[model samples]
Target chain A: MKIITVKKIENAVAQLAREANLFLRKDVLTALKKSYRLEKNKRSKLFLKAIIDNAVYARKEKLAICQDTGLPLVFIELGQDVRILGDFKQAVIKGIALGYRKGNFRESIVSDPLLRGKPVYQGAVIHMDIVKGSKIKITVMPKGFGCENKSQLKMFLPTVGIGEIKKFIIEAVKTAGPDACPPYVVGVGIGGTADYASLLAKKALLKRIKLQRGLSPACPPKQQWREGTVSGLERELLLQINKLNIGPMGLGGKTTALAVNIEAYPTHIAGLPVAVNISCHALRSATAVL
Target chain B: MPYAAQQQYCRDCPSDGKIMKILNAPIQEKYIRELKAGDEVTLSGTIYTVRDQAHKRLIQDIGRGKELPFDTKGAVIYYCGPAKAPKGRVIGSCGPTTSSRMDEFTPLLLKKELKAMIGKGRRSKEVIAAIKKYKAVYFLAPAGCGALISKYIKKAETVAYPDLGPEQILKLEVKGFPLIVGIDSQGGSIYDKD
Candidate 1:
């Protein structure tokens, strides 16, 4: 049995938060480069250039890539054989506060949602899972409010088919439009309960955009799942979404979405649930294994 | 120079039949008429920053016949909630927030003589109508371009609503803030026509 201390985990997370906010992932950068090569519209090209430049400026100065430093969504992949020595949640929160303070990032969270507003950006949302290995892997993805606001969830009858799902995804993208900061990466979660469906969609977003076409790394419970993996659905949705005129920043162009990722789980005989979680161009995340 | 002010300083800059102007806050009607969609401009002088919560409060004050915290006439209201300013910097990574979130509160603000808005994303139809009715303009800054946009702010001081944290109303001194005029007083919108 391997025992990991909480302090080591916190230190790693603090660094993760700083790094994620500082740099755009390599795969995402590649996707942006591809879009730049393919785009024909002058305005769209100009906007894409600015985005590319912004990434450079953010890294060189160690400044945040965007003002909305975003909420820290922590996903931990734990090994069943490993044991943590301290309070996992508290350690993560402490790491976030430390990282944000040192990183010169903004704290956007509020203590009260319906009442007074606070700019406290230090809080984090964490999701942990146990896997087969003994290694602890943590990924911190800072989710901006603009993209988070545009997520959609709808439940359909079991008779509903792929055509309907495709339609719903397109409509959601259109509805999200400029608000979600298009040139987006859409994560579609199908099956499972309403809540799990949404969670599954968000999980799909945590995967790198380049790896989405093949076997998704983070699959739901292997036992209860029966539906053929929807990598095909992912490709179909990607084709449809890019066809929409909502180009970079919804200003009209060919490169509206960077990728589409879908995750599915087995559900009740009478139910079919779907969720879409859209992520902005600055897909901020940093991972560390302990 | 504030990035916006640098753009504003190029008042006489014209290229390919496109006329560019450098404008200041508290803008006048004649200048508003001269401006058209797709024109490039740099805004300088004083601009107020307001997000959804502060906007709702302003609307409420108008209903109660209370004086606004800042004069609205000829003002440019920027919709943004900037990151916390690091030590020695005038402001942090301050970029425009989504303007549509403030749409319902906008017509009321526009009626009070707000000449222009600095934000990212498209405004609603009601907002476009009000921009035409009030002869105001809307500008777009590239979304996710926060670090670059921060260069436009020369200084920032919260004028009111300190309790709102990032949503606080800041009076910013900006110069040559680069922007493509997205909407004009005539109701022409860059997004709408395209």
Candidate 2:
């Protein structure tokens, strides 16, 4: 058995929050660079270039990538053999608040949803899972509302077809239009209960966008998947979304979406729940294992 | 200015061999009329920063006939909320927020002679109509490029509603701020013509 202190977890969360907000993930950055190189529209090209430059500037200057430093979401993979030394929940919430304060990130969480009270940073939405190894992995994703507000979910009949699902996903992006920044990383969650599916979709955004074909030299060769698998669906959906031509910032071009990531789980025979979560080009997340 | 000479005004763009115009803020109605949808331009001058909460307060104040913190006539409003400035910095990452959230209050502000708005996303049909009626313009800053955009903001100072936290209004002095004309005075928009 391995032991981990809550203080260590807290400190790790704090660091992860700052890093996630300040630095664009490597895979995301590479995708943006590739998009910039291939973008045909002059306006789209300029916007992509600005995005790339912004990431670089944010990293070098240690500044938040966007003012909407976002609501901090903590995802933890805890090994079953690892026993924590302190109150895990409090440690995470404290860590998030401390990190936001330390980084000067915006306090975006409103105390009350309907009455609309003061925005505070004392809480975080945390998801924890137990795995086999002794190591603990923590990932922080700063979900900006611009795209989060555009996320959609539909509980389809068990009899529905793949085309219907595809249509629903595309329509979600269409409705998002220029509102949520485009060149989006689309996350699709399939085959779970309604709430669980939404969570899965949100989690899918953390998947690194693997470049296909000649998009990026640094990206490893594309992984192979069976014709009926989730990976194959992801590739097909990506192609269809880019065809929307929403482009960078929705100015209209062939590079509407950078990547589409899907995560699926076995579900009851009664319903098929699919959720789509769109993230802007500033797909920010940081992960560390200890 | 001759078209050729106007094209020479800024060398940072026109990479596609297109003309990129430069506009100074507190922009005149006539100048706004000359801008067409999809025109790439660089903006310079003073603008006010506002977000959802600030807009709510502004509209409420207008309803109560209370004095506004800044002049609305010919003033430019950017839908943005900046991060707290780090040490030795003028301001932290500041970028345009989605404009549609403010669609409810936009027409009234347009009626108040607000000349332009800077934000990402499409405006409502009513807001677009108001733009035509008032001859105002809607510009889009590159979304999610906050760190790069902050470089153009030479100064930022909170002007009102300090208790609103990040959503407080700020007065910003900007130079060479990049923008694309999303909707022009004639009701034409980059999103669609019809």
Candidate 3:
């Protein structure tokens, strides 16, 4: 029975959009540093150094880390108990338009994909969900075009099995090579329909950059996993993916992928759908709770 | 057996100075399939800008044998879709969109004598083969280095496909634009060797 004003959402989105572009999240940065140390290829090591330097410069000058600035993808977790007081969509779009203008981020959205048309809107994509909660949560993930362009999804026969899934992921990464910008995060969505699986794959990427800083209450203690028993499937997948040696920027090194995240949903008996979404180290996303 | 020594042989290349001028204003066509592995050249001229959607349309147009909006001979095309310019600024944060997406269209363009390309990322085998056949070269500008690249562009004007917005075909005049050799006429790729 709580009324939330659209204006609050607008302001929150604007602030989040600007912040996400200018700053690299702490978890992503930490992971990058760790990868930098473990990288074996000299060229990749140098490349990682340059990436780190660019991040530092971007932060100091309050500029975007990459030119694409990405589309403003807004994930909304709306409380069923709350009603919006005004035009929520318009307010959010307005905020995004204004934020891009102020932040000096690029307007990469076009109105239509065919006939080479004009840009009717400023933001790229916005996703929303209403869930059972008393508080509203909004997350902004501004994904650059390089990694976004490399995302791939395909549905296989129900009997394709896990081995096929692994092959698909490896092929996708190999095809992506240095283009997706390496030292990247790979999110794999297994099960569900083709479209839903792809969406989940992208959603899994929105999980905050993994951290080594301290214990996460959301995750079981590390030793518990070491003892084996949890979803050992995901842990094993993580180990295999990191061993690919695609390395940073595909120059060949120790860490091609920073982490591999997987999410699953029950699917129809006819098919097994898989989608892989790659995210660079920038991992720029912010959430606001209302 | 040091890594530095291993890199030395890969980095050495012969530099040939053959300058090509892009004249007749916008939409110059240059064949890229004929260039070699280690040639150097000063590119003087006008180049058109397009990325993603434009490439898709170009492929479709070629498939349909429809007359494209511009000529393709001896042309140096730059892969970029710039932001809307503010007042008094020639262009906004203009940078190279990843070039791999354009791979499917590049060989088609090379057949028509499209000579040079400027972009980032590794080109596909089709593109490299076309470059070798047409004697064209691919140039790589630094990725994510838009702010620096914008300084080299002296003037910008929309030439064709105005409706494409940022992906519109625009004639740009650039000076001293820095780029590294990507694919040479000999079918050699710098991305793989480097």
Q: Candidate 3 DockQ score?
A: 0.20
Taken over the whole model, the C-alpha lDDT of each candidate is 0.82, 0.87, 0.69
DockQ of each: 0.50, 0.68, 0.20
Interface RMSD of 1: 3.0
Q: TM-score for every candidate vs. truth? A: 0.91, 0.95, 0.76
lDDT of 2 by residue, A71-160 (tens): 888999999999899899999898899899999888888877897776878878899999998999999999999999999999999999
> Which number leads on TM-score?
2
lDDT string for model 1 (A1-290, tens) is 89999998889999999999889888787778778777777777767777887788878767788888788999999999998999988899999888988877876888677775666755888898989988999999999988899999999999987788889999999888877777888988988999999999999887776632222212223343444447656666676788887888767877888888888899999989999999988888989989
lDDT of 1: 0.82
Best by DockQ: 2
Off by over 4 Å in 2: A215-227, B1-19
Candidate 1 ranges with C-alpha deviation above 4 Å: A211-229, B1-19
CAPRI class assigned to model 1: medium
Who wins the lDDT comparison? Answer: 2
Mind sharing the TM-score for model 1?
0.91
